[model samples]
Target: MNAPTMKTELMDAIKYDEPFRAHAIYYAIQQGYVQIDDPYNGLPADMDYDAIKKMQHANILQMCTVKIFTIPFGQGMHAIYLANCENDARAKHFTLYRQHAQRIQNASRRMDVSLYCEETGTHEVIRETKRRAAEFPWYVGVVGW
Candidate 1:
């Protein structure tokens, strides 16, 4: 399906308060973004910015778009399954590397490095990577076409 249709469907899901399913569609389409708490998934009730940021930093923010299941209750209650990708060797490597980099005690002395290593003078590469990362992340098996 096209992006516009997908986006509309996502918005509709959220507007209807179908929380988890909404996020699943969003992550399936928009990478690096997700709803804060999905009751169907058993997330903490007190989710806040700090919690969300923690998830983002750990790269665990995206929902599972490849597969999803939802059970709707007549009174707007629902159970949802947003199945995210399983961690593989590459993801583990990057996660560890990011953790090691973030451990520097000096506040201003940390060097910035991206997992995909587009750290230098190539604006085009950066832009392309950003596009792919957001529109079709490699982990989703949608990139490199």
Candidate 2:
């Protein structure tokens, strides 16, 4: 019923009624009494880098945290949503906009945008709309806030 009892019974069975030399070979392999043929290939069998920079990228998905997204809805009103990521926040913002933006005053004015901004002085804000997943990222965020 337990490990020791099972091990004892197995050892007794192997010792008393084993067919030919199979018992000896099994025990030799189990107890490391025989030498095994092995060749070392130029590949990693475990995590290659133990450091932060070399850590696997997919492993960081578990490190994701709740992010606060403050997005403008309609008519000078701001909506806040606590989400896991930006996409989720965007989805919630869209749902709320559909429910409330139409009844608000001057809802269309919220869509107005100026390509030029005074914050950075000369540089304009560039917005990328396309979603890309195939290529490696060009930059990495080292700043932890």
Candidate 3:
């Protein structure tokens, strides 16, 4: 969608508490803001303090939208799955990962976004890999498109 139209829709969606609008807000920030160099961190920075504040506000708005739309469903699914996997450690890990996945899904409201990162499997494979690597350290590999 065009920038103005997308911004208007995003503002309206934010008013109604729609999480998917975070994607639009993200796009708007990327489109309208300037990136600057950070002096201390030696990294790219945001020179416009006002724009940064606006972006942060948009992010908070998106988070609120996610809380409103997805928290209940996320809690329900977490409860159900955790109950089902009550005794199995691996299953518990999977369940926690599922919860994290739900949070990411809630944040982005996109199944594709949820699937994009290996980090989304935080409580399961990612945690397991770290846990097992204390002595017999090894890398867990992932291939993504």
lDDT value for candidate 1?
0.34
Ranking by lDDT: 3, 1, 2
Candidate 1 stretches with Cα past 4 Å from truth are 1-4, 32-145
Cα lDDT tens digits for candidate 3, 1-145: 4334444555555554444444444444565542222112221244454554666666655343211012223323322111112233224334444543223112122212212235564434232333343331122232231
- Distance from true position, residue 101, model 3, in Å? 27
Evaluate residue 133 in candidate 3 and report its C-alpha lDDT on the 0 to 100 scale: 39
Query: Which of candidates 2 and 3 reaches a greater lDDT?
Result: 3
Give each model's whole-structure lDDT. Answer: 0.34, 0.32, 0.35
List the candidate numbers ranked by TM-score, top first.
2, 3, 1
Q: What range of 10 consecutive residues in model 1 has the weakest lDDT sum? A: 102-111
Enumerate residue pairs that collide in model 1.
none
Which whole-number lDDT from 0 to 100 does residue 4 have in model 3?
44
Q: Which regions of candidate 3 fall more than 4 Å away from where they truly are?
A: 1-4, 32-62, 65-145
lDDT measured at residue 85 in model 1 versus the true structure, 0 to 100: 30
**Which pairs clash in the backbone of model 2?**
none
Tens-place lDDT per residue, model 1, 1-145, is 4334555665665544444545455444444333423222323344354544554445453322322222232254322222223233234324433421211111111111122333453433222332344332132111111
